[model samples]
Target chain A: MGQFFVFIKKEFYHIFRDRWTMIILLILPVIMLTLFGFAITTEVKNTKLGVFDPSKDIATRSIIQRLQANEYFILKKFISNPDRIEDEFQRGEVGLIIVFPEKFYENLLHTGEGQIQLITDGSDPNNAITLTNYATNIVASYQQELNKTAVIPYQIVPEIKLLYNPRLKGAYNFVPGIMGMILMLICAMMTSVAIAREKEKGTMELLLVSPMKPLVVILSKVVPYFFVSIINLATILLLSVYVLEVPVTGSLFWLIIISLIYIFLSLALGILISSLVNSQVVALLISGAVLMMPVLLLSGMIFPVESMPYLLQLLSNAVPARWFIMAIKKLMIKGLDVTSIYKELIILGSMAFFFIVVSLKTFKNRL
Target chain B: MQVIEAENLTKRFGKFTAVDSISFDVKEGEIFGFLGANGAGKTTAMRMLCGLIKPTSGQGIVAGYDIKKQSENVKANIGYMSQRFSIYEDLKVWENLRLFAGIYGIPNRKINDRIDELLKRLGFESEKDTLVKSLPLGWKQKLAFLVAIVHEPKVVFLDEPTGGVDPASRRQFWELIYEATDRGITVFVTTHYMEEAEYCNRVSIMVDGRIEAMDSPRNLKNKFEAESMDEVFHKLARKSTRTGD
Candidate 1:
């Protein structure tokens, strides 16, 4: 035990003495948090809006008032001629335009026929889709208000209700993903590189010839990286709560317990990688290409797994981060208790067990 | 008493025989030189003695512990210094010493005093806190040798410990080796430098994964009809069928 402590102290000295490693360990989490929180966002607000309403009737005016009153749009200008709509879009001053035909109110009241057009910049497809959806919802709501006084037969309206993230904030989605990514970054990548460094420098041979057990050497190497990962976890959670306004409404204790399990799995993976490779550059390449790439692309961090190809979705099931991110989303955003996340807990727990067993076996076998 | 005993110790990697049925013994407190050219199986044999690798087929004992069955005990009772710099370059002088001593299971109270004595003896009291990377290569090599034996093991294996040192530093390194032998510590060292072999009490020359000749340097010179250990080594190494590793 004393030997273990001494080895851990040496590991810390290695980390603290190197400026680049210190920066990566302590500051990179904050940078990733802010980058995901504020910089990369899907929620668009305060979009400049253009209008071409020739009738200027009370009904058209009410819809215009509703769009302006909401937070998504700003009334930039009213184009006079329909022919100039193309020129208005070419100016690029506004992202969306609304045009109501002449005699809109008269058509709706007397003949029960009205047409309103919503045009958006399709170059940015995601933004265009969101804007179109918001406009359609507002128009549907206005029609519903009209239908309350006069019943219209054979008119079907679909109701779409979002459950957990009602406002569709990107923070709610990415906070869990950032936790998965940063934990893997610190625990797996750093630990592997650190162990491989000893081998590369010939220090591992010295260590092997000593009285210390192989287990002690490996445990000591990972302990410091594990603590750093915990600090990163706290940084991510704190930033998500205070800065991004994403809260942990479920049991904090269970959330932490699950995160610790995932951390253990990552550490085991690091040991496995270090055992297979004898140099730091190879360790870094494997961790970056094999570990980080899967965590980023296939773990459902940036894309939905269900929408992917069948083979890819099957491959994602093997990624430990997918289970961790799923459980985190449940606990943080949906505010689900532990019972609701039993599937995720079981999957992550088994993966941790499997990785630890395989890594230990390979560690002993390789030497 | 023999500190290391090997009977037909052999290691094979697939079809390649790295160390083939080599047998040897070394008495306590003697500087036993392991001489070989590149890929002459010098490292492979040293690794087996230090309990770092498993022998394919052999009977061996290191520090009274069976190399195969009690490798942990063998490891505890032995010290090893490799051709490469084994100490952590980023760590301070004292930190490297303390780390190795602690790993060897030296009592906590004895480590500081031992470190102090080492630093003082090496005239490094003022540089205890200095990072090892900044030290001169010779000083680093000397420090590595000291750190390896901090626990006072029965046997110390040095694999080309003075590989790249200047002649003066190499001379001082041999003085340290003499000092270690005076303390009754058996030294097993490998070197490419022929003059360094003359300093060893006994020298063994390996050719083609086998020891061709082993005797006192004076005896080896008389038997081979050569004036220097270099001529004696070349006489045996010329029979090697294998190329450099």
Candidate 2:
């Protein structure tokens, strides 16, 4: 244990003395969290919408009012001629256009039905779909209000509620996910690279040939990183809670416990990677390509595993981050207890055990 | 008693043998040199003796520990310096000394005094607090050697420990090795420079994984009928390649 402490002190020196590594370890998490929090969002707001209202009727005006009130669309301009609608959309200024024919109200009064055209720029297919859906629902709601006073026997009523995030705050959803990704990247990749660096410099041979046991050496290398990762975790958590005003509905203790578990798994994975590869570059490539990418993609951080293809879903089972994200979301967002996420806990425990065992085996084999 | 003894020791990576069947013995407190060119199996044999690597088929005893069953025990009793300067670059000179001493389970109170003594002896007292990466290559090499022997192991294995340093630094390094031998610690070293071989009490020349010649430097020169160890090394190298072909 004393030897381990001394070794860990050296590892700390390695991290703190090097300017480049210090910058990477301390600055990267903040930059990544802020960039991902602001840039990547699921909610659509302030989309430019164009109107081609030839009807000049009260009912059509009411539908436009309802669309504007929802905050999903910003009224860019009104085009008198239909020909200019295509050009505005092509210029990328307009995301959607609402067109009502000249006799819209008259037709609705006589035949109880009117045609309203929704011309959307399909270039950004996701936003286009969302804008069209929003416009359709507003028009349906306006018609229902009209039908209440009118003698229309058949009416379609639209009721919409934005659940879970009524204000559509992007930070609330992304901050937790970014926490998991950044922690995993910092903890796993950094530790593995550090170990591989010692090997590359031939320092590891000196350590092994000393009186230090192999387990002590491995533990010492990982212990400093474990503490560094915890500091990063605390930084991210404080940023999300105080700076972003994101809620942690569950117990703070549980969140920390889970994060520590994931950190250990990542560190073990790094040690395993360092054992297999002899160079820092190869270790980085393996950590990023084999570990980080899968965590980012399949961990349900960006893509939901339930909606993914069957093979990808099956492959995601191998990624520890998937389970971590699930547990974090449940704890931070849903306020679930440890008992509520026992299965996720089990998966994390098993993965941590598996990685540690594999790393130890590989270390023994190499020595 | 023999500090190191090997018989028919061989190491094979798949079908390619890195160290062929060779036998040798080193008495306690002797400065034994394992000399060869690159890929001459000098490092392979040293690694086997230090217990960093296992021999595929062979028998050896290091520090009275069986090479087959007590490899870890052998490691515990030996100090090894690889070809590269293996000291931690980001650590201070004293910190590096403290870490190795700690690894050998040296008492904390003893470590401080020992580190101070070593820094003074190595003439690094002025730069003891500077990070090792800031030190010159020669200084780093000397510091690594000092750290390797700080624990006072039974034997120290130096693998090309003087490869890139200047001749003055190399001479200073040999002085340190002799100083350690004077304290009754055996020195098992490998080197490519034939001049350094002269400092060894006994030298073994390896060619293609097998020792072609083993003797004192004077005896080796006389047997090859050469005026210097360099000419003797050339004659043996040329003779071995011709036979291999």
Tens-digit lDDT track of model 2 for B159-187: 88999899999999999889889888899
Top candidate when judged by lDDT against the true structure = 1
Chain B TM-score list for all models: 0.98, 0.95
**Number of the predicted model whose DockQ against the real structure is largest:** 1
TM-score of chain B for predicted candidate 2: 0.95
Residue A234 of model 2 has an lDDT of 86
Evaluated on chain B only, what is the TM-score of candidate 1?
0.98
Instruction: Give a tens-digit lDDT track for model 1, residues A79-166.
Output: 9988988888799888899999999999888777678899998989989988887777777777778778886622344655557886
- Expressed as tens digits, the lDDT of each residue in A1-367 for candidate 2 is 7888888888888888889788878888888777766666655788888888988888778888888887888888888889887798778888888899987888878776688899887777876766777777778778777878876534454456455554556676677778778878887798889989988988888877776788888888888888878888988888778876677888889889988889989988989998999899999999999988998898888888899999999999988989888898888877878887788899999999998899999987887
- In model 2 chain A, the worst 10-residue window by lDDT is A153-162
Per-candidate DockQ vs. reference? 0.84, 0.69
RMSD for each of the candidates: 2.2, 3.6
- Candidate 2 structure lDDT: 0.85
